[model samples]
Target chain A: MTAVLDRAAPAPTPLRRDRRRWVWGLAAVGLVGWALVASGLFSGPVLNPAGSGQFGRFAAAALRPELDPGFLRVLADSALVTVAYAVLGAGLAVVGGALGALAVARTTWGRRRTGWLVARGVVAVPRGLHEAVWGLLLVNVLGLDPWVGVLAIAIPFAAVTATVFAGILDEVPRAAYTALLAAGAGRTTAALYGLLPLATGRLLSYAFYRLECAVRSAVVLGLIGAGGLGYQLALSFASLRWEQVWTTVYALAALCLLADLGGRTVRHRVAEPRPGAGRDRVLSGAVLAVVALTAWAGWYLALSPATLWSVRAREQLDYVLSAAWPPSTEGPLLREVLGAAVDTVLMSVLAIAFATAGAVALAGVAACPHRAGPARRAVGGVVRAVLLLLRAVPPPVWALVLLFVMLPGILPGALALGVYTLGVLGRLVGEAVEEADRRPRETLLAAGATSAGAWLYGTAPALVGPVLALAAYRWEVAVRDAVLVGLLGAGGIGVVLSAATSSFDWPAVTTVLTAIVALSLCIDLLADRARAALR
Target chain B: MAVGERVAVVGASGAGKSTLLGVLDGTVPPTAGHVEVHGTDPAGLRGRALRRLRARTGTVRQHLDLPGPLRVVHNVNAGRLGSWSAARAAWSLLAPQGTAEVRAALDRVGLADRVHERTDRLSGGQRQRVAVARLLVQRPELVLADEPASALDPALADVVLELLGSLAVAGGGALVAALHDPALALRHCDRVVGLEHGRVVLDAPAASLGVTALEGFYGVSR
Candidate 1:
């Protein structure tokens, strides 16, 4: 191989492997092994055999969930609370993101690279931490106020939405904007007319996508003691009420399905806007519905601006700021933070690897091919529904439940995150599969290739690029979610942060938070590099 | 058409040239007439029997439906999927099998240097040649091509036609092509069949017809 490279020859070689992909593949395998070893899989037993009974109870409960009328009423109320938080949070994020996009957009920065870099850095801080972490921190300042849930979801989601929005803005054809400028329009006026019109469809599409995500985030926030379905779930789970837990899971899954269906419809409508119409009725109806929902959510949550600036809120904020100004650099804490960060990265790697593998395997069946036989379509529908349920249940819930069967270690957390990530990645990969060109597969089939062989030679190749891209995107997400599962002593920096926060160790908490932000930033950069290499 | 004969099917855009090719390849069945290839009625064949028959009949479709993200070697090797076991076919994607064979096929098509390049990165003409290279490796007893040289220059088109014709001759099989170029068709084929509105209006030896006769089939006065 070295000799071939030294020659730098363009001559036809005997099927030389892609060296870059080989290196990446080897590195991934090595990292997975190292992570497994670090997780102590080989050193001792990881499974808790005695807990099998408990696991069985949880599994059995799925077949017969709690159906008490009073319990059902509580669940319905909690579901409303969850929806309120999600609507308000996503709505707030969109408003904030739209404004922040202007600040971060390349058109606004122009040639000022440093200014753009700094603005990006500022957004990264908020985006780095998971929503649950924001919930924990907000609870300290806001106490039991409803603002805790909304702010927790909005803060991080706003940062993410802003980054995506800015990218969308930058990708629009700049020719229109520059022409507007050349025609004597002011920069603001020019961007408003030229860029905004071009990006509106994509931006609105993305906002709806965020709303679906916000629904999930709000549930995770509830697990951390904010008021929602997850709060009820957490309570039932603590009492070993398996039936109630199953009930909550079902409700959450139904809610997720609703959001998914709604978001998909709006995204499709936005992508293919009705031609020569005054306005699409579906689009108009969707927008109007969202506005009405947001208003109702605000009223239902009893959100008040005065609560944000109340005296107690100010005093707690000042105290926390003062205590957290000089972050702890104690030797043991720093060492612990470093160790936990490594565990976090490894857990995320294992999770992503597992998710990617599962997603790829399921993508073919999960995608409902238009011309498929009835049985295949039925299988696809079931697979898609299973995926929805997998993602509907939060990672923390998965971690806790999985711990019942498996011993408390990194494996359970990794698997929990893996399953959740698979739910998300599978749908994404399936969509890619659905959208793939069908001609190649048909061509191969016509050439007498077996169905499986044809797919391998044709459909699979087209999907490799997209599947990897989606996996890379999901890997970054899995890292943030590792914290959620880790909060239950699953393994990662989240454990450390939870400990610090419980002890009211503000300085230590601040240090761990910073470390998390820094770790996420590094992973984001690494994932970007990996994606570019794959491309 | 006799074994080892080369036939060119020519007509206007919607003269059902593609549909005829499709029927020959067993994708579209003939509605009114009976058809047989390699002494077997493809419409009645099922499973392994159908696949075995199909493996002997190779086609270069008009769309050149090759997976673009795959390496050129893999795309060329795809021609062997019908004969190879599924496991071998899959493993070949990771570690290509019969490289020398693939290389030789590509070399004949003047694309040997692009053996490791992604198929999508190639130009339209190069991709067409790659498609031709795929059929070369398949070693089908019956060859089918539709506008195989549509993207190529006159010289390259001639070269491709010669390769397809020679491959058919080597296997003692007939070559059937739907061509647009009257001169190329008249030069390379032994027989010419002209169709308009799905009806065969003209069928004669290529040697008996001039380019002007074929051009007339295309509604071209010049």
Candidate 2:
């Protein structure tokens, strides 16, 4: 009986091998199909209002972007609105996130049943919906004003910020917090004097990062006709005025870059150790000025209760839902919508693949410690700067730029989305590499290996699993971004949804939105699977 | 080779016996006092230089300090890290350098059979012998042990102390070990020094260190 069982087990060896090969083959096919779709090889009917013959003319118009005097004025106004929205939104997010983080952080709030459960639920609900979805909901309730955009961005951003803040707080040494508690300090006092002080440096850095993201989201709020660069881009695209679209996109990109630089400067200044009274006074003065300006801007932007609870708000919300609910799934649109959904998934996969490759290359260089000479350090700094720049510019702006240079196709959209994803994934990968256990690398260094060699042998193996997990997570993020990029007329499910919404085809809009939600959930599931496999 | 070259560590509670041993082994650097081992100033060395200085000294901690996740043979081979190339050191993690050397070291410390076992699975006494095996592999010019036998039984502590003394004598390497028991220090070490409140109270040959000297070190009448 034992001999028979052994023979039977051996018989399944080739069969198991074949099954594994088949799964790999299926994965490869899916990947190749995605690549082809991203490269715009799939043919379909053009949804363009203009004839296909006029494609060249549109392309030409995009090349010489119009910068007339009136155009500059609009650009300035949009830029101001964008900055105000970002600042106000980020301010609210910080306050809300701080409160929420305090509630969730075990060091501050004892892990009681009701409070912990409520705080966790709050964190879970807001972050589950995308910022765009928040924007849509707020626009319905608060009209198309800038305050609606601010609330929309702030709500989701605050939830994400709270989670990250709590994570940072958890890393603070437990001994310090415990000592404060033992000394009869209350939860609030412990948070203020013990945990918060220890975590302030890291929290400030993370806040700046979120500020960068908020600026990008602020631009997207324009898609709902909230009077920003996105609104102007949408108008220009509708009228086939490619030059105006390009100019608006350029202005948006510039604002993003400026915000990126300003955030970096602020982070550096706040992080510096101001030893003397003079330096302390200067820092304190700056903090006061920032607070005053932020308050003034929030009031100016009309983020007050009166604006959010106006009588007309109810009617507008009803109108929006009446136009969007009970999705239409019939007619020739069904096939077209399904095809666009597949295209969106393909774009996400391809973009993630490209970003992963870029991140690995850059992280290898950036993970080197400062001991690698000034030149290497300088190069690493440059790589980090480039990453920040890439991340700072929103995917929509990148889509506009690529759309102008490349032929109007899915390839441009994929490339734009990929570049944006690279910035995010690269930073995460570099951090993981930097934070890995240093002992093995030290061992390698002690044994006469060069710095690079040590990293390759010791750090790379330790970090690869985490890096892959990060990349997979970014893939899910890229899927959402890819849909947004499609709103720039790059041919995906988002383009279909944008067309439907513009035409007031509420049923069609609902169908497309449902598909997007489903697609995103699937991507999230896949990312989770990848992470589990690596673990 | 030289009589005074062999070190003798003695101290009462909180007198920093471990701290002195750490400084000698190039681990806990001294804040005020200068340290020179074999006419080389270790304080000025940084990066690679510090690593090189550390390689010439063998250190055994009171808690074993073995990589608990690793095998005994691999932990022993960590002593050869400074001597091997990076590639060789990494490869030694998989296939250790000269099983014969490891075997001989283990045999010398009476742990020849436990060489393939996990370091955490060993008993307190066996783990101390493994630490001795590492010291045997290092073969440094000086060995600094911080209360190496404090956690072991009296009989096992004696055996470990005797083995350390014999190894130092055989290699002509300087040996400095902290001990709470004056009897063990006198029985195994050539000289004994007693410290009280970070200050030396008694410095004398092992034979001369009697009950009165111990009483002075502990600030008690005996």
Candidate 3:
């Protein structure tokens, strides 16, 4: 019976055979789409050689870790700001997610499926959208209040958290719920007694996951003038202070890693159920204390509810509303916007393809830590660390850094996105390789086949399907990041969007926002279909 | 064969017992034959017709093809996939369909409580039982077993074979299984058709065929 499950399930043979052909066909279409856009990508020389001196300085600065005392103090302070934003942002996401989850609960609307779908969809709107875009949008209405930074992070985080919370709620045992119902208990009492206890642990762990994401997003918010290490980094980047930029980057990296380590620790502790009541109590206390401190810091920023309704804020919002009404479709500007969007799509496609290809080589070593000598394993470790740094620094930061070496254009954006995407794709491909069946590999090894040859014959076939699916998923993400990559330094529709937003060109900004949302949805749908097909 | 007839097709490797079963299951068209199954020509069925015919005739292959990732209940429920509307079937995955009916089917195979458990986590014999449970849920007029117990231990294999036999007889349906071992054919089956090189070499009641008399069916035709 192993043969039936090994190669095929009960799915008919024709469907099985046709699916393989369909995958290849989709891949070909993707390539042709990329080619069409790529062919029209260039007009003039893509890069200027004038920045070679700055590039050299930047290369030299990488050899020296940032250690100046005054600069170190600034980094430390900014680091605190970034963490506070993340903590407060995550706290806000939790509150918002809880409220949103209530709206999404099926029992709330009863048989009104459309209401549930609408609630779920409204929650999903912020997901996959760039936090920088949120920052820009909020800043337009709210000015530079601390709420802009917090809300930008909170909105999307809440949207995703709500969906996950609902999933956890759905999985909670219904026995207590049924019992409560039989006793004529209200939905509120039953949910509180039955669902909350079951869901809190998983939701807390997931909130920790969101915290790590929030930290990264807050850093991205810096590009749109929301204060943090990202703001400082962008400043240092603008003045060609390579060493200072690297120092700020190192601090940001430290903050991200710390958040990740702490989140993992908390999640691990939360997951341990047996013989850990005292420890769980202590951990929960610590979490609450930290949250209180973060809320205090967030409050200390002097943002008041009164400021939200301030005459100036209201006037600015009114001005923006009047200005942005009715998106512009001027013939010349419309063509230019479309061209830039096409460029953005092409760059993202190129980025994913390059990242997937390079990641394969990186994954080969990473998947097998016992690959030959200790020297080779050490090299693999070093490579893995570098890739971690690449992804952890975030794409916009990479774009800013790469701006010195290459001209501001689609090419630089593609390179930046590709480098960042490599880290993600490498991890995915490595996991796929590790999970694949090893019997054929063993047989080949026993027959004196070379390790690489054994992998080629055995592991490659299994890796191909999953890797393709993951690469497509990553491409969707890359496209989202590509928007901000241009806004940061490299040129894309983000540059146009940024300019439009700055001059309060509401119509043009609306046009750009619409284009991005449309593109994002289209790519998301296409990738979803492809991933489903692969499954 | 009559509606309640029980038959066994015995063969060595490369014999066409599986091919014949496939043709009877409406999955494979015969090169040239009457190909009669359940008062209809299975080879001539198409689309909805083919699916409807196959729904009343459950076939278990050597590989015991229950989806490993799904719960035992879902695998069991998949037996009625042919009868379910696409939306109903899809929605059933979110929450199980006909839970009581599925549990009843599982009870017959001695795995009524493992319905919610992932099929992959089960032992090999248990997975085979889950597959049998699927056939039980199907309620097919004909039970076709294609070396279904080839992968099981001897004791477990006997349990599976006996369950298939008893279930078919209890449900008043015919049972036809392809067997590799002639001894198993003699023990569990009432009548045997010994196939060699895609043709029947011997046909008789199990009570009449002795151990020595099964040698011709076991010999390699190649």
Candidate 4:
């Protein structure tokens, strides 16, 4: 009825409708580009002097992963440094996040609206930009020290952690908190004893999950000469030694897989542990791991409060801030910044659109049952491995690598991000597929429904909501990443920010940073609403 | 005082039926009275000892609180979680812990093939049976259930109560259940205990209880 009434009313011009259709078509094309980039089968879009020949060689090198013992040993050292930094960074982030969460929790601090707004603003600044960008900014001040590496991961991570932690804390059963408060317990005590325990497991799991992200960030931070497997990879990539890069990549992948596995084990164990030596053993192992990793990280990085407050460091930071103050509101600057922001937003949408599409297509294959045809099984394994690599390498790394074969445009940056997002979205979509109730599909098949028919009628219904939620989440991430990818010369606000930073144009950098921060928070809020609607 | 004494406790929603069974299984404190199960006073048992007491007495509750995310085999294995060492217990989650025992328990409940399936996908009745299978794996000296059949239809309820009766009777242990239906109690139980407003109003052999007796005990007339 609505469509018929609209058609009968003052109709949109055919030209306007065609333009709308064209925009969707471009998104569809971007989605296709996502697949081509993932599969390494598209080349014309990029002015690749190396092209597919080089891309294929690089892709094949991943298959025949360099297993040289000497180099593998070096890779292992880099891996340790990566894990150590991530553990330390994520640990500190948890502490900082917890305090932020407490400060911002509406339940306890709802009366202080100004404080809450200020806290939120503080959290968004770090979380709105990618960790590598933070790394670059830190390098200018901290310079060649492991503290640079550690703080690079810790700062933005802490910000993201604070936001997520606050959200989780806000969700804890308020009845208990209120009950304790009513019973005359202080608000802080009530929160600690009543609410914190309730949300701690979730907080821990999220922290562990962030460890996986931190590992990725730690490597990307390496691109700015911060120490880790990523630093080593950056060095090797710069020299065009794909073989050594693969070794480092393999090491990095192992670290990620280990972190992922350990995280899952701890989450499950802590979520429900029974009386026995089993729980005791697991708990102790976890404590041992955390203590050892954090200690080693701190010791290795030589983290001290002394250096942070050093006159030189403080003076440099002050100088940078002074230079950037009263963010230039000039009309021309505004136009330039606005244009960059638009490019960033469009790039993110394209990246996320393509990533979700690619993920949806491959999810069926990735989640195929082992009982399926052997050929299908092999294809599934290969696809899953590619996805693992895609996710395992940070988005910035993908952007940097793509820059070699592709033109320095948002397209390459978007493609790189799409590939990275594919790894994440593919797993999410696949898990949703795997977790769906198989009984309906089975019944359909048993009743002589074709496999495709059963999937369409039974499985598809359950997947729609979760896939949408994942897409929303990926979009928020892609937006933040779009700015970061500008570091790789991807056309976006990051380029503007990067150009300004290199030339000591602090005012421009500050303006661009403010814009990026605002854009990301808005995107994040929109995505949060989308997820809330799912509930 | 034979081992398999089929005792039925009848009560309204808040008549302390669950608390009574919980005391016997060492899950709740009596506060005023001492209780014994298999000659062991459970009032003072703590830590491992309390867990052991619980592991020995398989008490099914009205709410089937099985973790739905785990496989049927894992849910069943939860019955013996207290008995297994920590390593075996944790490792069991990775791989099926004692597959034969898990399969046998599932077989008794007619869910042999579903041992590897996630428990949440099962129907309401199937989930209740999975709890029963967990009780079977527990191999308790006494079985205590508080209104386990409240969620099932009449016929399914009868079948489940009868299965519980036999699972207890065959082992020469005891089956004590809190029930809503007076008929199931009179038909399946040897002794019936009815409580009204947290106090026992009637205790008699099920064979001697009639419709009038139950109605009077419940303070209802028909």
Candidate 5:
């Protein structure tokens, strides 16, 4: 084709996809095909109808959870430990994030694009790994120390927090900052006087959001024996005590709800502070509460700095490093890693596609719109709770449970991650719905259009952009979370890594981890490109 | 320009008025000509020296580049950022310092009651007055204002210009403001410098110029 369109040629149809989008669309279709083939769905029977009886028992146990007073007390204690881990982990992440943001921020690098890129690259290594992976590695060194749970969450979350904080800081209008610099403020002081205030609301809101995620990550870490609710769940799950597993799951769900509610309250207050101020009282109270909770969490965990430098810790570290060095480049190991990496990508793509579809379907009912009828409100509340429960029960738990009825395959694993992600994507999509401008819909309705017609013309059009963007963003997260689900022999690099670790093949473990990080980085870049294209 | 003399720089859009102010404030370096602010070339200076020079040269940009989410008091206190220690500057955001002075400055701008309000919540004219209040707290020896009263009505604009003029006179400093209105320029300033296409078209004592003549430099015919 010519670089310039012929003057005589008619314009292309508006509905037609541009070349870039067509290319992306084709690539997407190709990837889906690859995922399906790799899933081996057509090659074999992937059903285990007999296991449904067992799955049924697990489902029924959700209704009559193990409510023995003794078990309840144990759950209560474990729940506190989970809370402590979440609080301390999230709190430390925020602090580390602040420092990391400064290190990586464009404002800090200014014209030094290379330095900024380098900092971002360094951060991606930690950010690419899941909390569970960190927990696994830390377990090798720390061996059941409370620090493992905290650090696992803190490391990856801090990297994420840094990325987000830097974005927030970067997005602040630079006029105020430049004006401060013109007025002779030092770089740090200028940023403080200018950038910080503008970014504070978003930063605080994100911190609260991270706390919510930390609560979930803490539970996930517990699954790998970090000692919390997930540990109890795992213990019961191993013994096939479905009732006790459901009880632990419910307890975990309640903790998640509390964290989500508290975080949402703070985020709202921060977003719209009360008029006048010595400082916002609600915000001050929340900050004070977090500080108190963090202190208590630290004390309760009995975290000692000495543990990090202890002889045994250093020995384990040295041993692991020596064993893991010169990561296995053997032909068989490399080939397996390559295959598993593709499987991980396919699993994530399927999971996100499933989640996006489900989220879009449920988002309308999930969003609690003002002026909605009582019946609508009740459905919305129930949908919201179900979404919460879906997300709260860690992905590994979902993976194991799904394995029972779906047979050992990628489909079950993808569905498990898909189900959990839907919980998150659904709420986000619902919020997008709630925040959408209602004027168009109302006007359409006022014009005597049917409700479905109004929704189609007004709501759906606006929602497509935000929902797609959220789904694309979550695609990156699903890939990382896929590692968690994959650990349970669900057909991903996680499975390979788990085997290597179990066999004490440290070199092979390193190779698998490298593959996971590489896959994640590729997905990260692809997701970014997709977002820009979509935008 | 003599100390305490209020000068108004007038020009069409993109006529280098802001560029000139930028050079004087040391934020923009002149490619050809030398610029000496308070007897030091800001471009030649470095580190502490440059900051000290800038601390004494307060600028009120046309956009009134105050952080919108910040409290009015903190925006006003940002003027003190040049001279205050970083620690003090950071602390002042949480628990404002020198509120008495800030209040007095706000009182002059008729925004005393809005000291605790967010800067963005104010109207355009009010935010402009807040910028003036910032300069008041800064107490710089040299004031540079770019269309500082553009958002205000005639009465408030006069009040704002008068405050700026008096501020310069009180501190034995010079006020060099870029004004869009010739009448205000004549009333508030001693010297008026007019430019077109980055070249100075007219430089005369305010007494030597008339509104109609200044209007010509603005390319206006009525």
Candidate 6:
């Protein structure tokens, strides 16, 4: 019952003591920095502009969204384009990811020396950058068009998908692969016959999930004038038309919800029993529909073969590179950029903490089926709904609304990023908790411990590794969001990037872009180490 | 004083016997029912008391429950989790100490030189032995095993049960094991308790547990 009694036996060796101290020191520094930022001692700007009449105008415009047939048509066109972009991007991503996965998979590369290490490094670098950043770079090189968005989503999504696919390939019963090899089957044949069948269901499920995510990224790409719902939303915001913004927001939300529902349904059906021994008709039908619709929509968006060779495309590409490379080193601008970078890091840390804590609490509730009564179930349902709502509302929109309510600083950005990450990490945490072996928790429970107590002792240790992994992943995501939030004037590197872009200061833009990439790489490295440690 | 203890657990297929082991280890809480160990309610035990109880309890399950990535020696030393600090457990994973004790436990279980090898590379029987070594390190006064020999060949099962019996006797630990093989239980245990429908149907000394008794317990007369 006493704390001292519960204190784990002392460290058996001096080496462990040093490692413990180092870990604690790193955590302490992060905590202290977060505390200082949260305390509001370094307030940067007045983000919320009152008496601007922007809200009223936005409200008036949104109220009559249903009346604007022209805008509705625009929305419909944008939605179709969004779907097309996601499908194309996902298709490319799947192909690229599969190839990349083979290159990285231990089964394929474990036998080779140099190729294996190079493949691992390549996988690491691409996965380190966010989809949005990838989009930014691609749009600059390819031009502000659908291809830009498609390539942007494809690159990072492929990297992540490849990593996941490699894991699945590794998990394939080695027995099957080995047997095939023993029978004189080639690596490709073994992979096709042995690994493919086992991994098909999982790979499809992951691809479907990525399709949902790509839809969201496509909307973000639209913010950069790539022509989608996000672009429309951005235009509405810039013009201070709240009503149009609401209408566009609602459309995007509906699209996300539909995708989420459809993906879930497909995933469930794929996992369930087959009616007959025939091919899955439902899967084939859905894939065909998606492909046909994407192709048609791409044609309608004027993303034709000729578009690729257009002078406008070339100019846009030139504009993007001119702004993104060779960043400026001007004195005052450099100070602002540095300050923003610090703020962005602070925002990411705080948001990740909030998400981790929230996820831990909710995951426990969601994991227990029996304890969740009607009321508890209802509350859980509400929490899940809130998470869906937050996820559907892009961080930019969340920031837009929060900027109206709170003073412009890291707080609003942090809150928005935290809400977004909560949706992600909470779902992951709940799944992790549910999937963990229940024997330990049941043991404590049978011994007369309460549910919470059982979870604290039994379930917590097993989940610590997974939960830490989820948190580290979320930290990577939050860093990317931190930059986007900076665009809302919540003083971060994003704000500097936005300002430079607005002023046509290509040198400054290049410098800020480099810093952002460097920061992202650093966070990625830390996350990789943390994941390894937990594993 | 040792109060007579009666425990019955019943569930359909996949009701989770392995989960029950976790309850004994202070890992999983029971949905309903009272479980007291040694007349002390482990339910009320918090941080220290719970840790102490967990440290002092020996548990084995159907599958090899050793941390597969770790060396066999470290897996065995996990039994000493109660006695060792968290730091020690982690360090021991990297470079295990108390080599002689670990070697002795392994040798007793028929795996003398595989101590430094990774547990994942071991066969099912070898892995089970490593787990037995862990139970030896725990040195608990009571043992709870969940279908411990279900995955093993009959010969290996006999070896595992023999090791469990000797370890329990040496530590003066009361052993509670769920066994599918009635003959093995009779051979290895001093007492046998039969559970069929989540309630104990028969409880008797090992010598008294015959085929008729088991058939009656299972509702099938052979």
Task: For each candidate in the order shown, give its overall lDDT on alpha carbons.
Answer: 0.91, 0.72, 0.76, 0.75, 0.84, 0.71
List the candidates ranked by TM-score, beginning with the highest.
Answer: 1, 6, 5, 3, 4, 2
By the TM-score metric, which is better: model 1 or model 2? 1
Residue A354 in model 5: shift from native, Å?
A: 1.3
Judge candidate 4 at residue B186 and give its lDDT. 89
What's chain A's TM-score in each predicted model? Answer: 0.96, 0.70, 0.87, 0.86, 0.94, 0.81
The C-alpha stretches of model 6 lying farther than 4 A from their native spots are: A1-32, A38-77, A96-144, A158-199, A235-250, A267-276, A315-336, A366-368, B1-222
Kindly list the per-residue Cα lDDT of model 5 for residues B1-222, writing each as its tens digit. Answer: 899999999988888898888777765568898988888776676666666677788788877666555568877776776667656765665577998898878877777778887666799999998889988998888889989989998878888888899999999999999999999999999999987777888889999889988888777323
Measured by lDDT, the strongest candidate is: 1
| lDDT of each residue in A1-535, candidate 1, tens digit only | 1232234334774556678877877887899899889777899998889999999989999999999999999999999999999999999999999999889988889999999999999999999999999999999999998999999999999999999999999999989899999999999999999999999999999999999999999899899889899999999999999999999999999999999999999999999987894988998899899999999999999989999999999999999999997999999999999999999989999999899999989988899888689999899999999999999999888999888888877899999999999999999999898899998888778889999899999898888877887888888899999987887679899999999999999999999999999999998998887788678
lDDT by residue (tens digit), candidate 6, A347-402? 88878877888888788665546656788888777777666766877786777777
Deviation from native of the Cα of residue A429 in model 4, angstroms: 1.2
List ranges where model 5 is wrong by over 4 Å. Answer: A1-16, B1-222
Assess each model's interface with DockQ, reporting 2 decimals per model.
Answer: 0.51, 0.05, 0.02, 0.01, 0.01, 0.07
Kindly provide the TM-score of model 4 when superposed on the true structure, using C-alpha atoms.
0.65
Q: Which tens-of-lDDT digit does each residue in B11-116 have in candidate 6?
A: 2334354455566665667788867776677888776676676655677766544544555676676566555665665565556678878777776666776867
lDDT of 2 at A341: 81
Model 3 over residues B51-87: C-alpha lDDT tens digits?
Answer: 6666677777666655455667777776766567657
Question: On a 0 to 1 TM-score scale, where does candidate 3 land against the true structure?
Answer: 0.67
Fnat per predicted structure, each in turn: 0.60, 0.03, 0.00, 0.00, 0.00, 0.02
The sequence of per-residue lDDT tens digits that candidate 5 reaches over residues A308-405 is: 99999999999999999989999999999998887888898888888888998998899998889999999999999999999988888898998888
Q: Write the per-residue lDDT of candidate 4 for residues A1-535, one digit (tens) a residue.
A: 1232123223211211224435544654665466445433354455677676777777677667667798778777877788778888888887887777766666646878888888778777888878877877887776666777778778888887877888899898889888999999997899888998899778878887888778777777776677778888888788877888788887777777787788888778778866665445876678688878898888876778788888988888888889889788888988999988877877787778778889999999899773599998899889888888888887777887787677676678778889999999998898888778775444323222335544543466567667878998888988888887887677888888888888988887788888988998898897777666543
Show model 4 residue runs off by greater than 4 Å.
Answer: A1-50, A63-70, A111-114, A275-279, A368-379, A532-535, B1-222
Chain B global fold similarity (TM-score) for predicted model 1 against the true chain B:
0.97
Who is ahead in DockQ, 2 or 6?
A: 6
lDDT of 6 at A322: 65
Docking class of 1: medium
**What are the per-model C-alpha RMSD values against the true structure?**
3.6, 10.1, 15.7, 16.2, 21.3, 8.7
Better of 4 and 5 by lDDT: 5
lDDT of 1: 0.91
- Candidate 2 local lDDT, A10-51, one digit each (tens): 111110123443564477468857676557556653144444
Residue pairs whose backbone atoms clash in candidate 3: A1-B63
